[model samples]
Target: MKESSSFGNLWQAPTARRLAHATSQTSPADSHALGRLIGAAWVVVAYAARGVLRGYLGDSMQSGGGVPFWRCAFGVGMQLGVLPALLAALCASKGGGSPLFPTPRRLERWNEAWLRTPSGVWEWAFGYVFGLFFTFDLLLVPMKTNVLAHHVVCLAFHGWVFFSPQRPGLQLVIAGEAVLEFGTGGSNLSMLLPGSDAVRAFFVLAMSASNTYGAVLTVRWLRLQRGRWVWLTLLPTILGILALRQLHVVNEVYKRAHSPAPP
Candidate 1:
């Protein structure tokens, strides 16, 4: 009896519990708030970038406060939309028998909760952010300020996947994808203007290599998990990635051939 009591006492110490909790996944509120915080941060970055570029050339972007507002809305949308959808899907796995609120803590030492969370909640969020930022940047390729602002925003979120203390390992696959982006346009978050094409082109080659590396790993992992129906999901993902690549190519070609060289 005393041995068990001592064991329980030792294990349940406040520090021990806190340490354990820290290693666990975050609550939805925490995760979502962090997402919004990151989103808002990019707005500040955009404004700062605007000021910096003003000294160099034409007018900086005048978003009329639209960028920050929309970015915040998107940030909140990320968790609210995804979490409940995941909760519903996960609960339905046993024909609607799973717990309504899955525990954030893990029984094992490694924080692998993201994988089992229904609909790949964390994985999907990370990928969604990646796709969202990539598409955002691609759309703004015509405007240097817009392109630079959102690229910084995207890279900020990209680094979050691995560097964040919570569930760092959860999104290694996404990290792999993001790592590829730096080669392409990641490092050039501020490589604005036409003169950057030659430099950007070289980076693109590196980007392509990283993309291929990540894609191979991503597809294999998806297949291992998604099994036969993987194509339903895999096809769109591959096409989208390829499309982003093409967009980059077109942007570089257009900028180089069409826009005047920077002064």
Candidate 2:
């Protein structure tokens, strides 16, 4: 008790107490309810905005009866929009260590210092991703099982951090995800405009590089935890699945980029 209070005093975080006694004092039920409400709200707003944009863009935006193209556009917009902030946070956290190999202290500060804010970049990004993916998963395009699974896993981990009062490795998960999705916008654009070989090439390079970095970071973080729990092992397994899917996307993009164009 004394140690926790002093720690809280050191950081002066308002939610620190709640974080310390998460299972008891912090009402996860309320957090879950509010999170769902916020996610649903974001989905509603995004769809309305998409509708407005589709109407304004006219036939230029139409593809597969206007579903797939806009879905990609929403993804591209969300991924690129939140990326700058996420990258800035990561760079700030990486300052004290080898940029490629983050040290334990640096990783701790990334979560304790920068990500301590209750409502900021992480929350906003989560809401956007949850809403955008849910909108697509349920309404816009339900047939894409791979995409659906990706969303499910992405949200599962993120949702844990968002709802749980005590977030042990918040920054690592969010930063890794942000980095992994860095090239996804280009991938979406490639799908929307298959003729744009440059975009497809960018997706291939970005996914390859970003996913590689994300995987390494995840491994380092898991090692830092010293095999804390068996469940945490799921991180690498899920990441491998996602990485393979992304690699498949990259391969397809490469093949299409090199293949002959229709006459």
What lDDT does candidate 2 reach at residue 118?
Answer: 46
**Best by the TM-score measure:** 2
Give the clashing residue pairs of candidate 2, or none. Answer: none
Checking candidate 1 for backbone clashes, the offending pairs are: none
Per-residue lDDT over 143-172 for candidate 1, one digit per residue giving the tens place of the 0 to 100 score: 455445645655654554334444333333
Stretches of model 2 off by over 4 angstroms after superposition: 1-45, 53-67, 86-103, 112-136, 226-232, 261-263
**Which candidate tops lDDT?**
2
Task: Report the Cα lDDT for residue 153, model 2.
Answer: 71
